[model samples]
Target chain A: MKHTLAVLVENRYGVLSRVASLFARRGYNIDSLAVGVTEDPTISRMTIVVRGDDLVLEQVTKQLNKLIDVIRVTDLGSEDTVERELALIKVNADVNNRSEIMQIADIFRAKIIDVASKSMVIEVTGDENKIRAIEQLLKPFGIKEMARTGKIALRRGPKSV
Target chain B: MKNINVYEKYDQQSDRMTGRTEKMTGARAIIECLYREGVDTIFGYPGGQVLPIYDALYDSKIRHVLVRHEQSAAHAADGYARATGKVGVCLATSGPGATNLVTGIATANMDSIPIVALTGQVPLSMIGNDAFQEANITGITLPITKHNYLLQDANDIPRVMKEAFHIASTGRPGPVLIDIPKDLTTELIDFHYPETVKLRSYNPTYEGNIQQIKKAAEEILRSYKPVIYAGGGVISANASEYLRALAEKVQAPVTTTLTGMGAFPVDHPLFLGMLGMHGTKYANYSIQESDLIIAVGARFDDRVTGKIRSFATNAKIIHIDVDPAEISKNVRVDIPIVGNARKVLEDLLKYVDKAPTDDWLQRIAHWKRSYPMHYIGGKDNIKPQYIIEQIHEACKDAIIVTEVGQHQMWAAQYFRFSEPRTFISSGGLGTMGFGFPASIGVKVARPDKVVFDISGDGSFQMSSQELATVVQENIPVIIAIFNNGYLGMVRQWQELFFDKRYSYTCIRNSVDFVKLAEAYGALGLRVTQPSEVRPAIEQAIASGRPTLIDFWVECEENVSPMVPAGAAINEILDLERKA
Candidate 1:
């Protein structure tokens, strides 16, 4: 099973490294991780996607809670969450297929962020499925480069996670 | 910052301060903070990078014990912490000195001993350049420590010191590190120790949820075969009294982990000796047959859970610990109470309904009588068990420490501990060179108590150089060496499983421990006969100086009731049955 956890931690220099080191030491698999400053500048929020059985996932959450810098850990897997991932993909495009690529990008609500004579960069923001769909479609166009911000999440209701 | 607000209040309530703020170097700030935190003793070895801190110590009232190796400093500090329940402090230089403390730090971390380790580092500019004596200690120790800090500026000293102590002494209580660069120690800043640390995310749960305690108590009442599995957490929380009360109210047999030995009185009728790999026959059997297991303050390490799937096959486990991560980490728990053991046990006793377990006690007594720990006696050869038993007879009240190996297991098995904090050893990391130096630490913490380190020959040689530290500092600790001429534990495995291939197991190398002790200007005795054991121990105690007793124990004597690796605890090989 895949689980996403929202971890609030002190915005210290090695906080990320400490969290990463724990996963490494315990041999837990991390699929994706996105970290950014929260409302409080002294605190940061990390959205981590992990794959494990229920027992392993429970261990991961409990272990993260044990870290001194970690303030809160909420498993978003069971909650109604708004998950997002940003991807900047550069594809090979010529004069002939440029219009078709742009139309497909438009259908997905993505934007053409940058362009060159023989290539164009497409910016997409969505859930993991949408990001994967666009990446698969652009693979046929010979992707030149691609970068993803992994997955960031927020709980849906007034209650904070 | 949270600290700035705290300093405002401290300034108004200035009983111990001359002024709200005073300019001082970072080195002075570190010493000042230690004084404010009530630290009177520290174990450390000085080097170039830490010269500023050591020089600052020169003018302070704190007494620093200089260990021969940085590792001893850490182990000694760990021993001090375990004995006194205070956060032990150790200082070291960069690179090798910092790295040397790794094993000891990991040892303390595994057992959840509170410690504050300070290491000197290269200046900020030289950190990544790999200058002389530079090491990324904070990075290396991240996985082992509860928390760590690398100081970027001198102004961060007061806050960092407060946080280090707060984080170390709270929660589950493990080692914390503070890496101070050379320049930071010399840099000047206004010193005002933070009065309180308000870390929003670092609040530890103290009291267990009342609902969980009620549920656990109901389960206890319903159980016919109940057993109490206690661990180091009981000792850490000082909840032995509560545990004893709970056990007496329910009449459940109590089995303890190696680290949990002294937490419960071994002589009690319901007390089963240390459980796990080297645990007693009765304790292991009790766990295997129990229907309900109340696990407190213990993580089920592999050594304790012989075959995890088959361990306590019939028991529904109720785990109580301060750290939530430890509850179901190894064994799947039914009732998990995330709180301090003392508080949880106290609340748990409220909803308890006493049940009869006379039949269960009778069964356990039968097991104890049938599978008692025993060894054959030889006419001329002095047995290691005999020596340990004799020591137990002579000094039952003494605090005992042991290095890792057969002797450690023998000490844990034979020397019964009746009081908390009396049996201190490296239970989690199983580090070999830990006992001799740790005995010094125990002695330092309790000057009125007798301290002895039961050590093996190979283990003793690893840190025997600490004898110089003991002699020079006038630490009166006794080290009883079971000199069997080999690393006995490994040799035993080889003898049983490896078709008796004694590859490198025979270390016939000759370095007389008596002469070695004498060279350090300490008393030394070599005992070849069993009769000399008692008199030697008596003389060492009466001499009131650092002493080493070298007992010539027999070879090929293995610890029995052994569960070979990967076997079920119930399928133990007893002394009468050879593998």
Candidate 2:
């Protein structure tokens, strides 16, 4: 099982390495990790996607909380939450397939951000499943390159991590 | 001139009204911070990067013991911490000096000893450039330390020092490192040590949840066969008295981890010696048969919980630990109480009622009698266990420290520890060269008590250079070197499991320890016969000088009642069974 954890830590140098290394040292793999400043400038929020069972999740959360710079950890797996990921797919495009790519992008509400003679870059933002869906549809058009922002999530209501 | 003088007087008055910050170099500030923290002694060796700090120490009153090796400094500080229950301090220069403390730091970290290790680093400008004697010690120590700081600015000295001590000695106490750059030590700053530390992410839960405590108490009362399994945390939290009270009230037999040797009175009828690998047979049997295991301050370490799947299969476990991460890291628990051991035990005592375990007690007593720790005696050759017994008979209250090996296990098995902090060894990391230097710190911490480092021929040689430090400082710690020709533990493993093809385990007597002790101006005694053990121990104590005794014990003696790796704790192979 994959767990989406929202971790708030002091916005300081080396804290990211501290957290990343903790997972590495403990033999826990981080599927995806995105860190950015939170509402408070002094605090940073990291959305981490990790694969583990309930016991592993509990250990991960407890261990993360042990770091002095870490302030809070919230597992959004069971909570009513909104998860989103952004991806940009650059695909091989020609006169014949360009229209087909655009049609697929339109259904996902994605945008064609960049276009070159041989390729077109489509930008998409949605949950992981939506991004995966769009990627599957555009695979026939030949994806030149793809970049993903991993997964970031927030509670469904006003409650914050 | 008159107006200027009046202004200066007013400024002085205001400085007195509010707490005044003193202008000093970062090196002086470091010493000042230690002074403010009430530290009177530090173990260290001076080098290039730390020269400024040594110069500052010239004017300070803090006593610094110059160790021959930087690793010894860290171990000495750790020993001091374990003995006195205060944060031990060690200092070293950059690069190799800092790296040498790595093993010692990990040792302390594993056993949860409170130690503050200050390492001098190359100047900020030269840090990444690979300057002379430069090392990123803070980065190197990250995973091993509880927390660490790289002091970039001189002004952060006071706060960093305060926080370092606070973090090192607090809940689940462990080593913390503070790397000071060379330039920062010479940089002048206004220093005022902070009185309080408030780390948002680091407040430990000291009190257990009342409901959980009630549940634990109810389970204790409901179980007819209960065992109190204690560990280092009992001593770390100073909850030995509470643990004893709980055990007595519940009428449960007490078994301890190796590090928890002295947490409960060893002589108490209800006490089962240590449990796990090389633990007493009765202790392992009691834990196996118990219906309820009130695990206090003990992590279910692999060595303690042999074959985790089969460990306490029929028992309900109540694990109480200060660190929540340790609650279910290895084994699942029935009731997990995350709190300080002393506080939780105190609260638990209020709710726990006397358990009905007479039949269980009788059964445990029967096992204890049937499987007592035993070793075959030789007519002329000294047995290692006999030597340990002699030491116990000689100094009943002495603080026994040990270097890692078969000798360490023998001491754990034979020596009777009656008080907390009396038996100190590297339990978790099992570092080989811990005991001798740590014993130096132990003696320094408790000058009134006798200190002994029970060492092995192989283990003592690792830190044998510390004889210079001990002799120079006049610390009268007796080092009993169990002189077995081979690395006994590994040799035993080979003898039992590896077809006895001794490869590299035979570390033959290369250096004469007696001569080495004499060379350092300390008394050196060699005991080859079994009868000479007690007399040499008495002479060492009476001499009031640093002494090393080389006891030529039976070379092939093995620590027994062993649970082979990955076997259940109850499935132990004793000497009789092995024979």
Candidate 3:
């Protein structure tokens, strides 16, 4: 099972390395990890996606909580949460496929961020499934380049997580 | 407020708050902070990067023991901490010096020993440039240390030092590191050491949850066959008395981990000795067949829980530990109580009404009588087990330390440690060179007690250079080397599973340890006969100088009652031994 953990840690130097090193040392693989400054500048929020069984996930959460720099850890997978992944897809598009790509992008509510003579960049922001859907559709048009910011999540309600 | 209360306990540092600030170098600030923290001694090796700190120590009253290697410095500090229940301090310079301390720091971290390691770094401006003797030690030690810091400013010295001590000594105590650049040591600042720490997110839970405790109590009350499996945390929390009381109240058999050797009196009737891979046959059997297991301060490690699914299959486990993460990390539990071992044990004692477990006790007694730890006594050569037994008889109350290998397990089995902090060894990391240097720290901490390092010919050679430090510092510690002419543990494994393919396990006794000791100005004794063991030990103690006793024991003697790796602890592989 894949588990998403929302970890809030002190904004201190080497904290990221500490966390990354922990996973590496323990032989736990990180599927995806995205970190940024939280509402409190002194704290950083890291959305980490890891694949493991219940016991392994529990161990991951507990180990993260043990770090002194870490403030709190939440298993967002168990909470009512909204998750999103942003992707930028640059596809080789001509006049014929350009209009078709625009239509497909419009259906997905994606934006044509940049347009060039031979390629067009499509920016898509949605959950993993939605992003994957758009990426698949763009694949037929030949995706020249692509970039993705791994899943970041937020609880559904107003409650702080 | 919590931080204030914690620091106030060390009030000596809190009272000297003269409103005036005095200008001093960062190196002086480090020394001053240590003094205020009641640190009178340090273990370290000096180098160019740490020259500033050493210079500050030249005129100061703090006593610094110069170690031969940076690794020994960390181990010595760890031994000092375990012996005195105080945060140990180790210092080293940059690059190789800092890297050498990695193994020792990891060893301390694995066992949760309270230690503060200070290392020198290149100048702040030269940090990323990879200047001479520069290493990102804080980054290198990030995973091993509980917390680490790189000195960014000289003004942060006092706060960093104070916090380092606080973090190292508090909440499931573990090693912390602070890497100071050479420039920071020379930079001057107005020093005013912080009185308290205010890290809001760093508070640790000390009291177990009431509902969880209640559930654990119900399980304990309903148990027919109960056992108390204790670990190093009991000793760390100074809760051995509480653990003993709880065991007595429940009439439960007590088994300990390697690090938990002295957490319960070995001679007690209810004690089942150690339980795990190298544990006693009876204790492992009892754990496998128990109805309830009250795990105190022990993380059910792979060694303790072989084939985790089959471990304690019929038992309901109640795990009590200071670190909540340790619970269910390796093995699932019925009830988890997160708190200090001493406090949690006291809480459990409230509900531990006297219970009748005659049937369980009788079953365990049968196992004990039938499968006791025994060895063959031969007239031709000295047996390692016989030497351990003699040491037990001669110095029953002495502080015994061990380097990791066959000798460690033999010592654990043959010797009886009746008090906490008596048996100190490298349980988690199993580092080979720990015992010798660690004994020096132990002797320094407990000057009134006799200290001995039971070592192997293979393990002792790793840190034998420490004899120079021991002789120079005038710290008298006895070293008992079990000369089997092989890396005995790996050899045992090879003999059992790999069809006697010894490979590199056989080590030539090329180094004359007796001459090695004499060269370092220490007493050296060699004993090849069984009758000579006790006399040599007695003579070493009487000499009152650093002494090394080289005992030539029978080669290829394997530690028995072993559990094949990945098999359940209950399915122990036994070899024929004369009882």
Candidate 4:
């Protein structure tokens, strides 16, 4: 099973290496990883997705907690989390297919950011599945380029990630 | 709040319990602090000025295991550290003794294993005088250590000892040292151990960047042909599961660096074993062909990157590590994810999609079939490969340690391990005396696991005296010596690189190893025939005592797939044929 975990840690030198080193030493497989500042510049939040047996995932989360810089770790799967991803997809659009492409974009509430005579870039934001679903709809129009930010999740309500 | 406590028992201690009739010196304070810290053992030796530590050690509870050489102590400590997560301790006296420990310290530094080394200096005044048995031990080990202290002040003894242990065991974890002046050992100080450390220069980070995590996720979703180049970092970060999810989600194949052996299970389809000098051809090729190389916790050692400029030419590299120095030190990276691998990986996993890569898997499978790690050790009488296989079978995932020689190479080529800290050979140092003491250290660290010392005749004799330690400690390690009766690897060097005028290579008559083992109260076996190898290993494992199987291998046998020392990774001498 795949589990995506959100982590908040102190921004300091060698902190990332230590965490990566812990994963490497412990034999954890990180599929895709992204890190950046949250609301505060001193702290950074990381969203990690891993695939493993339930026991191994539990062990990984437990071990991650021991690092000094790691302030919080949460598996957003069981939480009421607001997950979002952004994809800038460029597809070839002609006068005949422009209306159809715009119609699908309208359905997902995606925005048209850039448009050339031959191609139009559509920016979409949602969960992973929603982004994939939107990308699938635009493929028939001859997809020219695609760029996606994997996934980032924040717990909804009084709690924040 | 400059408060200090000396052996403070929360309960109560009558100050008059053990009135010190004798004076306490800086040297005695070191031993006293170590005893208070509950240190049970130290792998070290005594010489010159450090005789003070040894003398004080006699009255101490800590048992010191004297290594024949100082370097072995460092390696032993490293082995102990890897097996157990605690910081390993080692001690060596001044000058030559201190100089000898350099290799082991560097090894610990390179591998990021935590070790605390104590070395003696001549005296504070004589430091720059180059007095008898005086060398700048602190200056020499400065670069390799996480931090080091020159305890010219007698009052700093307890505090330095406490801080060294703390620094060594915490954060990125590597070796630390405390060098005491011989004169200071005689100087008196009010003994007090500092509980906390306040160092403005130190302190490691652990968190990941939320934006970077989002950016990486974006890359993964957009990348059509991505590959996760996992390193020892996965093991270090304790992030194997996170790495796996990220790979599986995007349908990315994974390859590991040499240090990354057990980060992922070897049998996993994603695992491409040990990609570096003498690495699998498929593994090396995969890194070269990868579109997006997600390097977890590994440094692109020169051995791993054939031609640094040409490495992963078309790939966008995602370099993740804890050491900031390591980030831009080697390869140029497109995404520099600076945080714990598990944390960074955890955040990135949120946005990755679980999808299958049919085309990439097919292409990789073809590469695997095309370039496999080959050993032409034929199905002849007693092949080295067969011998290694039988040893592995006899000692199922035992803590197998090796001395540096051709046998070390053979063992690496043959032994199948499933985890890190199981294969405890001196990978970076390749020290000769490494095996016996390292085996002891590993055994000490993991008492439940069976440990074995795999040595060649040349390597075993380095610290063969430690057999006494085995008999005394009742450690039942299997010492399988591939006795080619010569300094095997160098002889091969003489044969290949130099004209085979074998000088100082032949071991015409060494001490009878059978009697040697018997003398140490260990079981001994001399396996001559090919058929006897398996039974010998079986009997040795079952003996429940330290056993040495001196296998009289073909005298001229050589290690194949040799990478010329300090040469390009791809340059190998494929010479297995006997002339």
> What DockQ class does candidate 4 belong to?
incorrect
lDDT of 1 at B541: 90
Candidate 1 regions exceeding 4 Å error are B1-19, B576-579
Assess the local accuracy of residue B261 in candidate 1 as a C-alpha lDDT between 0 and 100. Answer: 86
Task: Report the lDDT tens digits of candidate 4 across residue range A31-92.
Answer: 75778888888888888877787666776785676554577778876788787888899999
What is the DockQ ranking, best to worst?
1, 3, 2, 4
- CAPRI accuracy category, model 2: high
Model 3 score (lDDT): 0.90
**In terms of TM-score, which candidate is stronger, 2 or 3?**
2
Candidate closest to the true structure, highest lDDT: 2
Write down the lDDT of every candidate, Cα atoms only. Answer: 0.90, 0.92, 0.90, 0.76
Q: Cα deviation in Å at residue A62, candidate 2?
A: 0.9
Candidate 4: where are CA atoms >4 Å away? A1-161, B1-29, B35-38, B59-61, B125-132, B186-188, B240-251, B377-380, B485-512, B554-579
Residue lDDT tens for model 3, A15-75: 8988998899889989999999998999999999999998889889888888888999999
User: Each model's fnat?
Assistant: 1.00, 0.75, 0.96, 0.00
* Model 2 segments more than 4 A misplaced: A94-96, B1-18, B576-579
TM-score of chain A of each: 0.97, 0.96, 0.97, 0.88
Give the per-residue lDDT of model 1 (tens digit) for B162-256: 99999999879999999999999999898888889978878899989988989999899999999999999999999999999999999999999
Q: Can you tell me the DockQ of model 2? A: 0.83
